[model samples]
Target: MIDLAKVDYQVILLPPSGGKINITDLIDAWTHEEMEDQISAKVTLSLKNVKREDGWMHQHVFLDKRLVLEATDGNGWREIFRGSVKAWKTDSENHTVHVVAYDPNYNITISKEHYYFKGGKTAAASIKEIASEQGIPIGVIDGPNKPLTKKLYKNSIANTMMERLKESERKGSGKYIIRSTKGKLSCLKEGNNSVIYELDDWTTESSSDERSIEKLITKVKIYGNSKGDARPKVEAVKTGKTEFGTTQEILYKSDFDNMKAANEAAAEILKEDGKPEINRPLIHPDIPWIRKGDKVRVNSGTINTMCIVKSVSRDMHSKKMMLQLKE
Candidate 1:
């Protein structure tokens, strides 16, 4: 329950063999930025009055060297970021050493490869195979068991990995996140009811809500495996929402060739996404442990609901964070 607490942080250099070098005493300031939209999470630190070329950092740290950032409120150290150094700069006049590091995703985003998976690969398996081939280590990959077929992708490993993860969306498993954490790749299912964290009154500063109609779809036009110019063979039970005008989504599922199954699926998709999306942003005391894809429960004056964390923006110095939650 550390609210607006005095936060102390450290920057550590992790050697290849093992062990860690404490760079906290030498650091002047640091910042961290992590988001689902960004390809890689990043940490930037300033070392005070270190040698320009022959400093402790310059001598031991090289590209791909591990850098870890942690913070404490006297409750003990909590790791916030672990990444490989990409580049650095030495400020001679300012008497500072500026270093920039990013998660392993930085390496994946620069790599271009052609991938061809014959058929019958689950969403988790598909991304694991690609990450494995690219030499990235794998963590827990909890995804839906829907078997995909013939996933051919040609792009940077980061982009293709995201594309492969899109297949995890289905009825059984609602959504999945393809995240790289602590030098390991993971495809985790979103919104776990078992591990719901609370943004209670103590740590929550303020909150606001907004609405988005972008994903609202009224009617769904389902297409079968028929050839070109063929009309929709099946129609959903409920047509467009005439009250709010018409917003249509065409569902193309070759397996939905049967009329009954196609209509049911169309209605199901509409039921799931047909409503206006409510986006809530809460100003919470910065807690680095809260992560994207984690479910949180909130109960305020007329607001009582569970939500999935869509994004988090943290200020390392101020211990303030803006958490974006999805409905």
Candidate 2:
């Protein structure tokens, strides 16, 4: 078994000048968070009156330099984050420099343009194309192939793309994920993590609360455009109650021209309700490659089910991993 206390972290810096600097010796404390969308890290180092080679402040050269964090045992190393330095600051009295970095995707800005995607491809392909256009690297894709209809990106492609992806997730299609270590994006159809955390050993602890009502929807009404009528009316409704309850969601997608597609959309929207309670657990497991979208089955006294990993935060110095779990 790998020893958690033996795990180590190293920061590799590549400035514009093209040489690498190992900042492990200067770091005092570090923290990094890996999310489904992005990865970020912050390092605090003690550098006294450090100057740059170009006769400028040391912090200036690191403003946009490439930063990479890795975890290593005696055998080899594994990259955890890959991004450019975004901002930095120095403490006047402590002589400590605080540096923050984000994944390469954060640096990409979509150019405003009129864009439309003609159907006939998978959503993963569309997402990959969008990321390529924006200069973001493609990591892993685990999504289903659904005929993408007319998708429009008017002012900001990033905002529109993210919204559409989230909408797809709400429909229980797949998950769109962004990793920082390689600055890559991926779409996952289901949990890909093979690591299992058995809660029976008391190593995995869970804190969850179930809600009384979870956005229950008993009615679905779909409407399509009319030929001659000015305003469109309801075309069809689910064979159930028509009255609104305390918790109800109404889905109206005019783009769906057929009742079959519209009904499917309504069912997808309603699936978001009545899900298992999400929880965050601090797991001290001796494992590697614990990341978002990893699948693990929990067998404990209270809970025994499979869940997908949502977020992972690690402190290399402390040797602890806080994981966010979702059903």
Best by TM-score: 1
**Per-residue lDDT of candidate 1, residues 227-284 (tens digit):** 6877756533457555666788776666432465456657666766677878888887
> Residue 151 deviation, candidate 2, in Å?
2.5
lDDT (C-alpha) at residue 28 in model 1: 70
lDDT of 1 at 186: 76
List CA RMSD, all candidates: 3.6, 4.0
In order, candidate lDDTs are 0.71, 0.61
Evaluated against the true structure, the overall lDDT of model 1 is 0.71
Question: Which candidate gets the maximum lDDT versus the true structure?
Answer: 1
Candidate 1: how many backbone clashes?
0
